[model samples]
Target: MLMDKLREGAQGRGAKIVFWLIILSFSLAGVGSYLNRPADTSPAKVNDQPITAQEFDQAYQSERGRMQQQFGESFAELADNPEYVRQMRQAVLDRLINQLAVDQQAREAKIRIGDQQIKDTIRAMPEFQKDGQFNNELYLNLLSQARLDPNSFSESIRNQLLQQTWASSLTGTDFVLPSEVTLIDKLLQQTRDAQLYTVPVAHFQKTVSVTDAELETYYKANSNQFRSQEQVNVNFVELDAAALAANIKVEDRELRDYYEQHIDQYRTAERRQVAHILISDKDAAVAEKQAETVLTQLKGGADFAALAKEFSSDKLSARNGGELDWFERGVMDPEFEKAAFALSKPGELSAVVKSQFGLHIIKLVGVQPEHERPFDEVKADVLAKLKADKARDLFIDQQQKLSELAFENPDSLDVVSESMGLKLQQSGLMTTSTAKAPFDDAKLKQQAFAENLRDTNANSEVITVGEGKAYVLHILEHKPAMVRPLADVKADVEAAVKLQKAQVEAEKQAATLLSKLNNGEDVSALVKELDVKVESKTGISRTGATLVGTLLNELFRMPHPAADKPVRKLVAMPEGDQVILVLNKVTDTDQPSAAKSMLQTQLAQGRMIASQAALLQQARDAATIEYNPLFNSQPVSE
Candidate 1:
C-alpha cells in the first residue's frame, strides 16, 4: 500500500531515478572487503618515492591493454616490435611521473577527496554497472582480477580526480575566443572536390616475379618472422566441482533428512500488512494523550483512513491511509513489529503504542503467515543442496591434497592423480597460439613451458582455470623455438614476396601519374594505359570513407586550388593500396547549429587538454626525478 501511494504521486524522472539512488547507496558496501606484495625494485622515482618495478610493469600492462582495445589488430602487428615496445614503456613511465607529480602537488595544496566522493564516483562508472545499476559483486571481481584492492583502487581514483580538479581550476584562463570557434567550425565544415584513382596492389601481382634465391635471401634476413613459437605437451590432473557434482549420488533418505534439518530455508517468514496513525508532539505525555484520543475516535467507528489522513504524523504513509506495506519480520522496530503481529484479524485496532519515533494507534490490515513448503514442492532444491554440499566438501579435501601432493612430489602429477582418483589428461604438442582449454591463459601457458619445470619434469603449482576448476600440470615434451625451413613454408614465402613487389610497383606507377598531374599535364593517358578510371567526388568531408584515411587526409591537407588550378599528390596506404589524388577545389560553408555546438565542444576539449599538458610539463620541470637501470627490457605486457 505504501508502494501504491508512492506510485500515485511519483512523476517522470523522479520515480525512475529513485531505484538507482537506492542502488547507488549500497554500491560500495562490500568494496572494502577482500581488499600484498614483495619489496619491488624501483624503475624510477619522483620526490624520493620509488616507482617500484611491479608498479611500472602494471602501468605498462594497463597502457598496452588500452592500446589493444582502441586499436585492435593494428596494435597487435607492432606489439612485439622492440622499438614500439620501448616507446610504449617510456610513455607509460612518463604518465606515471606526471601523475605522481600532480599527486604530490595536490597534497601540498591540501586538496582532498572524501571517502563518500570516491565511492559515489565508483558507483556511477558505466563499466561497473549492469542493466543500469552498479553491480557490487562485478566491481569487486574486476578489482580482484586486476590484482587491485580497495585502498589501491581508491588512491588511483583519488589521484585522477586531483589531476582533473587541479587542471580545471588552473584552466580558468584557458577560454576559447569566438573568432577561434568560428575558424575551427569553418575548418571542420570545409569540403573538398577531388579526383581519385586507386592503384590496387593485387593488380600488379601478376607482373612481379620471385625466385628461390630471393626467397632464401628474404627467409635468412627475417628468420624471426618464420620462427615457430616454443611449444610443449602437458599431462595434468584437474578438479572441477561441477564436474564432480554430475557423478555424486544422494539417496532419498539423505534428501529428506537434509530438508528436515534445514527446513527453515524452505519456509517463508510471517509478514504483516500494517497501517498506523501517529500523533507526535514535543512532549511524550501529550503525544500519548493525542494518540489515545485518535484510538477512541477509531473505536467509535470513525473511518480509519480518513482519521489517518487528518491526524498521522507519518505524512508519507498517512496519505495512503497510514499504510506501511507488507513487510516480513525484522524489517520494522522490534516493539512495533511485535504489537502489529499480535493482532489476529484484518481491521483489528491496537491500543495506543509508544515507540522510538512517536506514539501510534495501529491497525492490522492483513497477514501473510509463515509457512514451510511441502517436501514434494522443494524436493529438487533439497537434492541440489545435498549434491552441492557433498561436491564442495569433496572438492575442498581433494584440492588441498592436490596442492600438497603437487608440491611434495613436484616431479610428477601421477601421485596426486592416483591419490585423488582424478584421471591424468594428456594433450598434444601445443604452442601458446594453439593451446587447449586450461592452458589458453598466457600465464598458465608460461608455467607449462617454464624452463625449471621443463628441465626437471616438475608439476606446476595448483592453478585455477576458473571457478570450481583447477589443475596441476607438468610438461611431457618441449620443442624449442625454431625457424620454419624454406621448403616447408615455400607457399607463404612466395605470397609475401609477391605482395611486397606488387605494393612497390603500385606506388611507383601512382607516383608517375602524380608527377604528371603536378606538372600540369594530363594524367588521362597514364590512367588509360594503366586500365584505371578516375572518380570525381564533390563535397568530401574529412571523414570520407571512399578513400583510405591516409589518402583522404592527404587530399584535405593539400592547398586550396588557385585560379582554377588543382593540387595533386600521391598517398600510400598501410594496406598496400596507393591513391593518386587531384584536389580540384576547397570550399567552406556555413555550419549548422549542431555542427557549431560540436565544434565548440571539440575546441573546448582541445583547449583543456593543452592546458593540462602544459601544467603537467611545468610540474615535471620542477620535480626531482631519477631513472634506474632495468636488467632486461621486457616486451610490452599484453
Candidate 2:
C-alpha cells in the first residue's frame, strides 16, 4: 500500500506508471545486461557497476550538501570521525545496493513507461508549473534551477518508486493468525477502575534527620565527587561577526547607480489579460486559424476579459477576469511573451499567440513602469559595510598582539593571557555524552575533541564560526580515560540502596495482591482492603501505546485465557515499583479494521528492525569491509 501511495504524487492523470517504466528501461539499458556483475571494485557491486571511489565521493558529496544547511561549518565532523564517516558511507552503499536490486527486478518484469506518461508526470510536479498548470518553459527552468538534467531527475523518481515497491514486497504480509488477533484484543484492554492510596515513604521522611556528623562523613567519603576533572582554562581573543558587520560601509551614490544600471532587474514585466477557447481534439492548423478569428473579434471592439470569462477553457485565470499577473521574462513561452509584450499600449489587443498550451488572444491593460532604487533606500546597506570594515581592522590588530604573545613566548600561555588582559576560562568536564556548548559552534566542538587535537598541549587550533568569525582554542590539559572512584559515589550508593529497598517492598505487595486475586477475591476489594491503589484502563487498542505505570506489555505476552488457569503478568515501573496485571476477560472484534490498524503500527516497527538487521547483514556479507589501520577503533580514546 505504501509503495502504491508513493506513486500518488507523481501520477499525472494516471500516466506516471507507464512513464516510470520507460525511465527504468533506459537506466537498466545503461547497465548493458550486467545486473549481476561480480562485486570486484572494493568488494561490492551496485547494478553491475563497479563501486568506484568516484561514485562513493559523488554520493558522499550529495549527502554532504544536503547536510550543509543544517551543519554549516561543522560538515567536517563526518570526515574527521572515522566511525561516523564509515557509517554514512555504508548507508550510501546499502541504498545503492537496494536500488540496484529493485531496478533489476523492474527490468525482469518488463515494465515499460510511455512517453506521454513521462510528460504527464513531469507536468504534475508543482516545481515545473507556471501558475497551477504545466508549462514546458517552466519545467525546463525548474530543471535548470536544481542543476539536474530532466531525464536524470525523472529516473531518480522512478528508482525511488521501484525501491519502495521492492521493499513492500519483501516485508508486507497478510498472514496474521487468529490467535495473534485474539492475543492483540486481550492486550488492548485497559480496564482502569480507581486508584487511591497514601505513600508511607513521605511519613518516614520527616523523622529521617541527617546529622552534621553524618553529612561530614558523607562529604568525606564522597570528596572525590567534588574533585573536578582537569579543565582547560583557556586565554583567548574573542571576535564577533556582528561587530564586523556594524563597521562595514557601502556608499549611497554607488547603490543608486547600481540600481539604475540594473533597473531592468527590478522592472515589473508586462502581463496579458488573455484567454483561450480550446478545441481539445482539434487540428493544430485549424485551431490556430480559429483562435485568430477570436483575436480579430477582440481587435474589432470585443471586451477581452469579458470574452475570456465566456469562452476561455483556462478556467483558473478565466474566472478571475483573465488577468494574468505580472510575470518576468523567460517565465512564459517565448512566443506568448513576444506577442504579449509587443502590445505596448493599453486596450490594444494582440493577434492570436501560439504556445505549447495552444492559442490565446491577448489584451494589454495599464502598464506598471519600473522604479529604480534611490540612494536613500540603500543607505543602511552602506552603513553595514562601513561597520564590517571597521570590525575587521580592530580584529586584525588584536589578533596580531595575541599571535606575538603566544608564538614568541611559547613556553607559557600566561604571556598572552596577562598582556591581552584575557580571562582564563575553564570548561566543565566534557565527554562525547555531554551536550555541546551553545556558544561553541559545531566545528569548534568537533575540533576540540578531535583525535588529532587530543594530547597536543598548548597548541592553538582555529575553527570557523560562520560570518567570517573564527575561534582560536589552546588546549592546556588533557585527561585520558580512567575508572570512576567508588568513594566519589556515596550519595548515588545511598539512592541505589533506597530504590532497591522500595522495589523489594513493592514486589512483596504485588505478590500478596496477586495471591488474593487468585483465591477468588475481587481485585478491587483486595486493593481497597490493603490500602493499595487499583488502576484500570478500558478500550485500549492492541496497537496502542502502553499506558504509564501499567504492566500492559507483560499482560499482552502472557498465555491465552483458559478455564484451568488465569493469565497473570508483572512489569517493573520507572520508579522501581512492580505491577501485576491479569486479563479478566477477552472478546472478538472486526478483523479487517483491527488488522489494518494493528499491521500499520506493527509493520512500521517491524520494518525499522528488519531494515536495520537487513542492512547490517548486507554490510557483513560484503567482502573484506576493512577500516583504515591508522584509525583508532577503540571504543574510548585514550
Candidate No. with top lDDT: 1
Please provide, for model 1 over 480-594, each residue's C-alpha lDDT reduced to its tens digit, 9 standing for 90 to 100: 9999888888888888889998998898898887777788888777777675657999988885586667777788789888977887777777888788788988888775546
Candidate 1: regions farther than 4 A off: 1-166, 245-393, 403-421, 452-454, 457-461, 474-477, 519-525, 591-593, 623-638
Please provide TM-scores, in order, for all candidate models, with all chains considered together: 0.59, 0.59
**Per-model C-alpha lDDT, please?**
0.81, 0.57
lDDT of 2 by residue, 510-535 (tens): 77776766686766765555445555
The positional error of residue 343 in candidate 2, measured at the CA in angstroms, is 2.4
Model 2: per-residue Cα lDDT at residue 499:
52
The TM-score obtained by model 1 is: 0.59
lDDT of 1 at 32: 39
Off by over 4 Å in 2: 1-62, 68-79, 90-231, 247-282, 306-311, 385-409, 412-440, 446-456, 477-481, 497-509, 521-531, 535-568, 582-638
